[model samples]
Target: MASSIPLRPLASQSELQAFYIGKDINDVPKPAVILDVAIIRRHCAAMLEATRELGVGFRAHVKTHKTPQIAHLQVGDIPNTPANFVISTVLEGETLLPLFQELFRAGRPVNVLYGIPLVPSQVPRLAHLAKQIAAGSISVMIDHPDQIDHLRGFRDIAGFAAGVFLKVDSGYHRAGLPPDGLNKGGLVEKIITMEKEGVIELIGVYSHNSLSYAGSTLEEGMQFLREEILGCREAIRQHTHLLSARQAKGKELVISVGATPQVVSIKGLLQGGALSPSRHELKALLHQEDSDDIGRITVELHAGVYPILDMQQLSTNTHTGPAEDEIAISVVAEVCSVYNNAERSTPEALIAAGSLALGREPCPSYPGWGVVSEWRRPKGPGRLIVQRISQEHAILGWEKGKGGEEGIPLRVGQSVRIFPNHACVTGALYGWYLVVDSSREGEGEGERVVDVWTRPTGW
Candidate 1:
């Protein structure tokens, strides 16, 4: 059971510093995986900013960074304002509830939405938590009629009308009923009636995507959401008398739509879907798509000794910047040897980090140290790019440098930080990253580890 606790600011900088850098376990040369907190914050912040343009109330998925510290970073010190955290489990909600409950007790409350839809098994725990927690503090999703019936019993048992978000198949089709799927009788009307009768409060409507497909090319997804929200609103109004009463009484219902890819790509397109709109929007939508696939084989048809592959797939964003210089490298191994003899004539080689370090997939070859920036080698031995990856190694090859050993020596046990084609994938691999500033500060050391921060690893 949850009871209101006095609000207190979480630990202090000195304490947090002590906890992380503190002597906790035996030293094991914690082969550090450096993270640029500032840069990461920039990427995450960009995503949040995009939501403003999307014109929806910001409820970031905490799954990206499961740590409370990182979660607070996402919140950016919004005092007296409850952080709107989106999650996938009740345990996740339970872990975060105390933090939010403290805010509520202090008169600065927040809300949490369990991203998963209601399943029969979840009802008992859901009821227990909601009953013990503050009113209107928790919400969950519901898609099928059977789930609603289960929720009704749970609500009755708990003696509290649980908030429900009618799941709609906006586009991604991962969950939620397809927009037309609601036509099999009166599921929509049933949900609307529950809201009116107070058995299940119609808190909001929700949607999701599979995240595997392109998710409707962002533009398509946005258009579909806009139309779905409008259509559902009309459908509810036309069929349900309860919602009509609530509308007449100035009640508002949330229309929550989330999909990192869709949200980031077309957030601004979702304006006017909110029960109420906020003044002054900030940032555009940004999605962290399939960035994990950094170095894998792509079947490029051709004829040669070996068909090499590009390395950009895993290293850079679609809009990656250009490279600084052009240098030539050779493929020590057979040209196509790196890609399981898929084809020939394409160039390939080996590089520093592999699939495990970044994500596993080949990226496009542009001239440069890595795929992070769009450095393409146009002249002579085109740019050397990473192709395939393993947990600790990467396959590299020159796009233009034609021979097995073109110009330079490529060997193992080489320590190199190839500029990643995409920064996000590379950023997530290690626990933390070292910040190095080579510029000297009036006789100070040329480089110093200025900042140290950890990234979220799991739930």
Candidate 2:
């Protein structure tokens, strides 16, 4: 039976942090979430620097790892840098209030966008959060007029008009109005009317190139980014003639687009000479002004999975680096039983993780739920993958015609780490992360737990 003391994950952060600070990663609970602090820091900082070099704004999404420790790092804590983030849940925004409060006190430029297409019921709570966060801090997404009707404009109620980003479909058909449909139902006129009536300050267009994840090369990812930029531009272009003088000459219209694959490909902008023409073309395309009648077009890049990468992100092949070096989080579980050539044709070991621990999101690169970290780089016996699962059981098996007939390398009680197919949902399974650092030297190459980051649960 499990202990009733409620020691970790369910315990308070202070209690958990005090207990796990100096422990080994293997000492943590089975099938726990693991975060590489150094790797995450490097990934987030590098992304910020790359976007800065490309002259684009960056809005980090907090829907992946909902912990404040990672969220703070993702917000760009350095002085003189504007801090921006988008949240998938109101709880995530509420959970980061202290961080926002700190930034507001320091007078750093800070904004948190509630990144769903607005519905009427969430307005009250969202407006409440807006009232307390910071001036010009809260923004909402709008793709329909009914959403605005229920929002009722935040002017009189919240003491300020809410900032709005018109969601553009970007050919994904996920959400938001398509660029070609801007004039279909007078949506552009509705947006102008909202701004004209002090109902909302049109913050410009927001999009995601999710289709890029299906791509296999960096060039394909870059093409998705270009298409995203063009789609956002087309939306803004459709509305230029209708903007009032103040709205037209007001803030620079910001275009925010990202999917980790697309954002990771932007690092090529700093690569020398190899894609010089592509870089120049992207720069020119990012800033285009047919006439002064329209406001300047600026850009903001947003992504969630780039911080703690996964096998799915690796399949995109956007960033140039070792896969093991970039992928951060993994599921560390112990082998419950070994099923070798007896009942299984190849080799399999029953692990302590199942659908609840390692998510079922599929990756095109491999034919399994997740890959064992031991063989992820193919240095040891062979690749062991989570091929089957129950509620709390996962079969760690090797593919047929593979592993060189050496059999499974795992002992019955030994622990194995798994790189999941989806980092975002996989992380949502645990309440806390067993923090470690793979960037530095230690008794365990990367197996010591340094800190515990607890996250708020549910929406």
Candidate 3:
């Protein structure tokens, strides 16, 4: 039996202000994670606008900002339509299930996709949780045939069928099944057969092209997307007979693609004419018609890190890079010491944030763990970089020849905001995000703690 978990009390605005308002970045304790709620709202709006323009649905991946407040922003104010959302963990699904249920009860179409693949041992708990909510409200991902059998056995015991989406390998080569080529593995056929046999209801197909993130140019990302769509189409083509059988039963298919880089690239391509052919191909795939000339297929995009822009997002833009001001989250650290190199040729300042706080993810575009934000020094040279990070200390260094005679002229106790390489991992390191109002004016004086949003960490 699972133990009931009590909900944490939300801190009142006045209570939060007593702890955070009027305190300067330097004075609010070191190595703290701060979130600009205003900026987050702007990012959410931009993503929704792009998806709307592209004529596709947006399913915000809550793995980045694992808070209900942020998730509410992603879903928007009107809850009439299903607020399409995805989660990376069962715990996250459990955490957000009640909210989704409440929305569903209020006549809102709410759907939650537990994006991760599952095993037999985990099916009971997931099924039990799913049973508590609206029928078909929760969906799971499956990439292999045996997992389907496992799900079937669990369903027989539990007396309820679960909705599942096929995880296709869209150049990520990680955990999904290959969508293209001959169906020698018979995965698609098996899935369709199982659906017909009432073992599991096939909800859709999902793909995550991670290669898009490492692609050097925007064209590369588009090419990957093209291949992904082609692959999905090929899968459907090979299983045409099976699809026809399923479609006759009034079943529709969904093509879900994600990864922040690809989502942003697709949005850019849809806006610009530079890649007309690719753009047209994507639109056709997204707006595909069936034999009866009905738009039976729907395209859903799932991305997590866009809500909190980081160094990786900026470098991966490949087009008009995001302005530094758009980055909403930052690690505020205080300088504990300053020292010279062994040869005394360069000086380095040690701060409080490190791998434990900012994460150890590599920033290939930047020289260090993270780049120093120009929030405080808008006109000053943005030369400071987190060159190295220990368990609890981040060593800050300036670009070669950019530091003056005394090496950046930094003093102990000085505060610096470090924008992490990956905001998702960095955000996971903290317990609560100190919400700041970016719309406020002046140097941190008007910045008040509007709320204290707690983050759901761990598995």
Q: Which candidate is the best by lDDT?
A: 2
Residue 445 C-alpha lDDT in model 2:
62
- Model 3 score (lDDT): 0.73
**What ranges in model 1 sit over 4 Å off?**
1-34, 43-56, 79-82, 127-133, 152-159, 183-185, 196-198, 209-242, 265-386, 390-394, 398-459
lDDT of each: 0.46, 0.79, 0.73
In angstroms, give how far residue 86 of model 3 lies from its true place: 1.3
Residue-by-residue lDDT tens digits, candidate 2, 276-370 = 66666776665564436456767788999898999899989885566567888988888888866657676678888899999889998878888
The collision pairs in model 2 are none
Mind sharing the TM-score for model 2? 0.93
- Candidate 3 backbone collisions, by pair: 82-109
TM-score of each: 0.60, 0.93, 0.89
Task: Give the total clashing residue pairs for model 2.
Answer: 0
Tally clashing residue pairs in candidate 3: 1
Instruction: Give the winner by lDDT: 2 or 3.
Output: 2
